[model samples]
Target: MGEDRRKEIKYHLSEEKIDELLREAKDDRRKERLGFLKNLYYGDSIAEAADREGRSAATGGRWADAWNEGGLEGLMPSFGGGRPPKLDEDEQEQLVEMLREGQPWKSQEIRHLLKQEFDVEYHPDYLGKFLRELGLSYAKPRPKRPWRPENPEEILEERVDDALDEDDQPHNKRKGDDEEGWIVDDDICTDGGTVLGFFDASQPQPYDNSRRVWYVDDPHVERPLVKTEDSAVGFYAVNGTSVVQWKETEEKEQICEVLEAVREQNPGKRILLVLDKHGSHICEYTRKRAHQLGIDLVFLPSGSPHLNPIEQVWKYLKWTMAPIIVENEDEFHELVKDVFDQVTQRVSFAKSWCEKFLDFQKFP
Candidate 1:
């Protein structure tokens, strides 16, 4: 059994009964045991109950056994024998299943559910810890495209395979047994091999914006909004190297230029650029240029920015420069280039995409 796991438990008092006694009971010791019993009755582990009540697990066991053999009278200081738990094994399992269905639960909402569903009530503060002990926590929902295909994962795999465009079996690792493995692109792409890269464009303006900042009564920080935008088209290879090309405007011409730069950077290697289906990217001129340069373009599904890994890189770059003020477009471009170069020189960016879509081998 797991460390958190306990043998079968049985409880004597209903939650209403416990709460009523808790309100009227005069003895602090009786109240403490009642609180412990309340938590234990609502499916908290012995360790959780003991920690919440500031008692030892062994003592909780004794009290629980006392309650099992006795009820409300079992929590009395005189009780000698062991008692039982509030929930039977089957009821506990059913509550777990029910709780999981209506997620992102508020403390009061969950209390209502417990009371209505099982006639139980747990302290609000103790509920969070209790849920964690049972393997649940609050989490933000990821954005999903409502119109996405039913087989998005399958389509994703097919897209990656098409991008590889090699005598490829759908194998993640192409390098032979004797060859050295790389965490980042390193010198492998330069030596002639398929290069997987994420492509994107960004037009960062010279304005300060941040998600959070420490403040006293009120946040009163003023930001400068300079009238200049820095356009950049870029490629970030899974091998740890990135190529950022500064552009005057975001157009098909600049898109082609970035594609050419990627090919020039990874000469002789097949370049598979995963990018979005923007008009500038999907235009005839850009496609012609990419095909001529031996590059394959794989467009991410529309409305799904999270599917492309490079989006994170752009967010990171912006967040890195959020506080600083730049004098001009030149200064902003230089800052963007420096930060992008420093952060993208690692294979960490591609891990999420690799895990979700590919049968990737372990990195050496």
Candidate 2:
């Protein structure tokens, strides 16, 4: 380190002016600059003043030069010498409008569009940041189709009532007589014998999953390509509080096996298995097996995967596995197993997913 040799020179300011500058400084950097000037005006050496302000002697020397050249105005921060923005005002406006139109776009697609339309190049990673600067944010694309029930609210209410009826208990007892009847309480229901399980299947591919990421535009940077040669279908069952079971398979026989295992696990409890109306789930053989195991296979309304809470688990699994680049089928299976283990360990996390995403409440 070199010492500042301008100790003989002095910078002067009126006491009232110093106080005014200190009071007017709105940020820490401005306050630091004012303090540096105050120390110099009170006969402190540049090195001592710089040390007091937690700055190096060379930095103090530059500030002293700025003070001599343009007074306090020179001490104001100046940001310069960076590459200019790739998108101009009009292009940014166009981009914002495009995003507001709600067309799902990947970062690479946006980057290619920018290059093709405006002759500007941005790295895939930096493009997200640039979009954020324009008040746009990246998000996972949700599947939306025009097919829906005419009375969705009624359907939802029916489903809730059906679930409650499956577990309803009588609050009032009847007298000991052959003709006596017990009163069933509509408001009171128990979850003890009823297990609410959501089921879904996902085929995780090797392609990088598109997700929300902070993007900026820089052409020189290169993002690593995620590649894989193997893929597998996952069958998962969650009861909101925890993952009851999961398996890797596409065969419908596996679904029967899962139901059987759940039956064995809960003994006499009735399994209310909520799942989408996939053909396999509604097939004769699958229904027979579920019936034998005392599992009520309740299907969601058509085109309504969002109604099932296990869909969130599938999304979480995909998000967890997105960054991993599996070399082969074995590695992919192992990674999936590891991620499943991590998720199943946190019971509260599973419960929250059920409550928040599926509106499935847990009973004590």
TM-score of each: 0.57, 0.44
Which parts of model 2 have CA positions greater than 4 angstroms off?
1-144, 167-192, 206-251, 344-364
User: Where does candidate 2 have its weakest 10-residue lDDT segment?
Assistant: 170-179
lDDT of 2 by residue, 1-364 (tens): 1444354444556867988989987877678878988888778877777779887565577667667767777665342335545664456667666655756777777777777878988877777776765545468877665676766545754654555454433211123422333332233233356665666666565454465445577423243443443323233444423333345553578767766665665554556666776777766666656655666666677787767655666667778766455566556667766776566444453465355434344322
lDDT of 1 at 1: 18
- Top-lDDT structure, candidate number: 1
What would the per-residue lDDT of candidate 1 be over residues 1-364, giving only the tens digit for each residue?
1333374567565889889989997877678888988888788887678669876554556556666776667558343445544453346556666777766677788789878988877788887775654455567766567877666666777777655545433222333422332122333242365678899888766565565767788765565556555477889898535799788788898778877678777776766778887898876566656665766677777666677888888888878777666666677788888888887886787887888775454121
Candidate 2 residue-wise lDDT at 364:
22
Q: lDDT for model 2, on a 0 to 1 scale?
A: 0.59
The true-versus-predicted C-alpha distance at residue 261 of model 2, in Å, is: 3.1
